[model samples]
Target: MKSLAELAEIRERMKSKVVLREGGNEIRVVVGMATCGIAAGARPVLNAFVEGVNRESLTDKVTVTQTGCIGICQYEPVVEVFQAGKEKVTYVEMTAEKAEKVLQEHIKGGRVVEEYTITHAKKA
Candidate 1:
């Protein structure tokens, strides 16, 4: 059981994350979290993005969220990045490590990690 002060600290931290999600002008990082995705390990992928975004102080520029089936069970654990002026990029078969790379290269550096993308998956 946490003391009131501890609980308040937890709430403050969570409020910051919630605020990040409420932004209207930030790049969106959507992770597929449907049953298939979870079975394939999407949870850690989602966490990686959220943590990385916060750690990098990119909360003002990025929003990480989850969604249901992306219509491709084989591509469970898919992540889609949407920026205002850029075409959406769909990354397939993602892991936590891959999420970090995507956050750095795609979200932060404006360069997609092509090897993790759907096109790359199809080619492999």
Candidate 2:
């Protein structure tokens, strides 16, 4: 049980993350969270992206959200990144570790983690 003050503090901490998801961001990270995705462990991958965005203070620039099946169940736990002026990049076979690296390299560093993306995954 938390005191009112404690709850308030928690709310404040979470408010930024909520805002990041709902609006005002240039980058959008969409994780497939359907039944298939969950069975394939998308929850941890989603958590990693959320935690990574918060840790890097990228909430202002990156928005993380979830969606239904991305029509790629064979590639469950898929993540798609969308930027206003760029093409969407779909990453498949995601794990928490891979999500973290995507946050660091693709989201923050302005370069896609090609090997983790569908285009590259299909090649290997």
Candidate 3:
């Protein structure tokens, strides 16, 4: 705030934490953040994805972003993963802990965490 150089420094630091949607990433992880989603705890789920991606050094491959209502209110706190040339996978009833597992098993390992997926929720 004191000088132009200091402002630039702050901007650079924050740019690392901000996920831009300009597109080049191999995968996109979107979190639903509608009113219902927030009530069901989407914020932490979103943060978890962001932090997990950086921690795993997959930021170049994955982009984590938030969007309003994903349609299924019952599935509040929902997360959707989109990979190029692949079907989108939706994960429901998410928690921060679940986010990490999804990061490791799904994002890094190239496998879907089916138990947390919408199809599994329907069966349950």
Candidate 4:
């Protein structure tokens, strides 16, 4: 906060860390954190995913982020997993437990948990 030059450098560093342009294949876990989602317990779901990724040492392979409304209020605590060159998997009604399972079975083992996915629940 001393000078504009220092501020610019800090901004650049933050941008680079958030952008994550390298690594050909990466997994993105997006948690909806809109008002409805928050009221429905999205924060814990998001935290769980972050912890799971770190616990499994998949930091380089997975990026966890938060988003606004996902347009499905009934499924407020929603999570979507997107892997490079593959279809997105939307998991509805998420909890910390479910998020952990997703991290283990899906992110690490490359298998989408059908039971948690929106498609399997006939809501996609």
Give per-residue CA lDDT, model 2, range 53-89, as digits (tens): 9899888888899999968899888999999999999
What lDDT does candidate 1 reach at residue 84? 89
For candidate 1, lDDT tens digit of each residue in 95-114?
99999999888898999999
What are the RMSDs of all candidates, in order? 2.9, 3.0, 3.9, 5.1
Worst 10 residues of 3 by lDDT: 15-24
* Inter-residue clash pairs, candidate 4: none
> Would you list the rank order by TM-score, best first?
2, 1, 3, 4
Q: Rank the candidates by lDDT, best first.
A: 2, 3, 1, 4
Question: TM-scores of all models?
Answer: 0.85, 0.87, 0.84, 0.79
Best by TM-score: 2
Candidate 3 residue spans exceeding 4 A from truth? 1-7, 10-23
lDDT by residue (5-117, candidate 4, tens digit) is: 99989988878665664654388899999999999999999999988888987887888999999799887799999887899999999999999898889999999999998
Which residue runs does candidate 2 get wrong by more than 4 Å?
10-23
- Give one digit per residue, the lDDT tens place, for model 3 in 26-67: 999999999999999999999999999988888778989989
- Name the weakest run of 10 consecutive residues (lDDT summed) in model 1: 16-25
Q: What lDDT does each candidate get?
A: 0.91, 0.92, 0.92, 0.88
Per-prediction count of colliding residue pairs?
A: 0, 0, 0, 0
